[model samples]
Target: MIKIGDFNKLKVKRKADFGYFLDGKTNNTKDDILLHNRLLGKNNINIGDEVKAFIFKDSEDRIAATLIEPKAKVGEIAMLKVVAHTKIGSFIDIGLPKDILVPFKARTYDLEKGEKYPFYIYVDKSNRLAATTDIDTYLTTDHEYNVGDTVTGVVYGFQTNNSAMIVVNNKYAGVILHNEYFTELKPGQELNLKVIKIYEDGKLGLSPRQNRKEELDVLESSIMSYLEGNDGFMRFNDKSTPEEIYTVFNSSKKNFKRALGVLMKKNLIIQNSEGTYLK
Candidate 1:
């Protein structure tokens, strides 16, 4: 049987001027899929040869088969680039002649062209090949992952609280709370995340922070750099607002104070109500 949006082993039944027709096991040629000559590469095909072809509908909505493997197949996840946008939906290049549509209803937000984001490929109810940014719905929580395991993921979106919704390893659902990260994360950005907790359903709670000592070191360095850049004086101090500290050092107010304390203990800086200065 020829299944659209999936691979099928079809037997070459007849030859045509443009290509060969692979039998769809139905009575007539109407269901026969066209396996174009160009798709066969340098290998010659003959009648009675069985080809493992990926089946899909072309731009014309006609059943087509290809020997070339797409970047991702149905029921899989991949980082696909948005190629075009339309009122109906956006299109993504799937390493095929006809790009796959990502219906607007399936998108969490408006996808910009040229930006690559992870998507889940699936056959819609209409039996059409489509991709979606609603990857959470497609990803499962069942995995062998454990807490403290480092995993890779792509930032797909942000919640109202600014937590990142991530597709871990392109298969599992994960999230990094806003407080767990000190930097701004954009959609489609790839990150190495540390698993802080595994939910009851197996969804991972992740963090992008490093060890306390390392983070302190980095924070102190950033403070020193800011001071040096400002002619050996810094405008922010322990009394600075949390927002100010975050904006300047991408850190929490408590961490900022700790870093400042470390710097002051080393006699590298002096802070007064006005601000801090190199000592």
Candidate 2:
């Protein structure tokens, strides 16, 4: 059967002035789908020649076939660029003659032209192809990724508490929870992230940076900021209680010591029995 919103290899049944009619493989007379003249991509099609084409509804809401492969097909996800918009919806460039609509109701935020978003493609209630950015329901936790694996994603949505929700590899569900990274993330931003943990529910926890040297650099910077905020004197040291270290550093005692050690090695700070102070 020829399924709309998918690719179908249909035999050319006959030729007409407008274009060739493709056999829908169904007995119904109305089952013949059209491969319109404008959509016939340079191929000299003959009757009985099977043409592999993407099937979709044309502007007139009639079934049609095109040689143009869309950015995504039914039940698949992809990053699609916004091309135009109307009061009701935003049109996406899916590499088709007719842009696919991401209905206003399906959008999670205001759509902007030229911006690309990870979208889920599906046939809407009207059986017409559409794209949607509100895709959390389409994401699944059944993934092959493991901790420490490098992955890329686009920021699609945000949690109420400022966590960034990401669409990983345009399919999997991933997130960088609040305060996971120091930088504030915005929608449509693409990021290269590292998988930090896989939850019991299979959701992925991600981090923006991972190298030990890079982590140390960030920690050192945070320590300097803390010292600057406290008049260049921090009343804590390696000998301080873990609770005291955590209260001041917002990190584990071990990490605090590492940052302090780096600062000491560089002679950027002086540690005495009284406390640690900037040199």
Candidate 3:
């Protein structure tokens, strides 16, 4: 049986003026997949020769065969680039002459052009190659992965509370909760994250936070450097909003305040309701 969107070892049924037709093994010549000459590369072939081919659909949605290995296959996860975005769906580059469709219904979030995201490739009901961002069904939590382990994840969706839904290493279910919010996040963004907590249901809670003391030191240096560059003073104080502080320092309020307290206790800066000033 010839499975579309996958590799198949098919015997060459016949030679055509344009290309060779690979037997689909369905006993129906009508189902014979085409292996175009341009796709043959450096391989020489003749009638009755068996060749391994990657089967997929062309721009006309007709079944075609290629010896070129695709970036991914059906039932596999791969980071695919969105080459085009349409109201109906997006198209992803699978390293083929024709890109694959990621239908709107197949995605958990709207995909943008030029953005790359991990997608679960599958053959839709129509037997057409398709991609999707909702990879939770393909994810697993049963593994040796543990808390505090450094991992990478791609932002895919958001929760009602503004938490980020993540696919850890494109395999495990993970989330960045609302409390761990930092800089702005968007779909298709790759983040180097840490496994902070594992829930009873086995869902992983992830964080982008670095070591606390080290983070404080970095934030302190960032602030002192900014103050020195900005005439040695800034009108910001501990009462400043986290958003404002983060905009200026790219740090959370907790780290910002801690750095300020450390600086103040050392008499390096003085603060009041109005503002903080370098002393």
Assess each prediction's global lDDT (C-alpha) against the native: 0.90, 0.86, 0.88
Give candidate 2 misplaced runs (Cα > 4 Å).
Answer: 26-31, 218-261, 268-279
User: Of the pair 1 and 3, which is ahead by TM-score?
Assistant: 1
Candidate 3 per-residue lDDT, tens place, 31-143, comes to 89899998887889999999999999898888999998889999988889999987778899998889988988888877778889889999988888899888877988875
Kindly list the per-residue Cα lDDT of model 1 for residues 1-279, writing each as its tens digit.
Answer: 567888899899999999999998899878889988888866688999998899998888888999998899999989999999998999999988899999989898778899999998999887789998877788889899888889998999998999999998888899999889878888899998889999888889998888789999999999999999999998899999999898878999999999999999999999999899998
Task: Report clashes for each candidate as comma-separated counts.
Answer: 0, 0, 0
Give, for candidate 3, the lowest lDDT window spanning 10 residues: 136-145
Which candidate tops TM-score? Answer: 1
lDDT agreement of model 1 with the native: 0.90
Cα RMSD, model 3: 2.2
Ranking by TM-score: 1, 3, 2
Of the candidates numbered 1 and 3, which has the greater lDDT value? 1
Location of the lowest summed lDDT over 10 successive residues in candidate 1: 36-45
**Best by the lDDT measure:** 1
Clashing pairs in 3: none
Candidate 3 Cα lDDT to native:
0.88
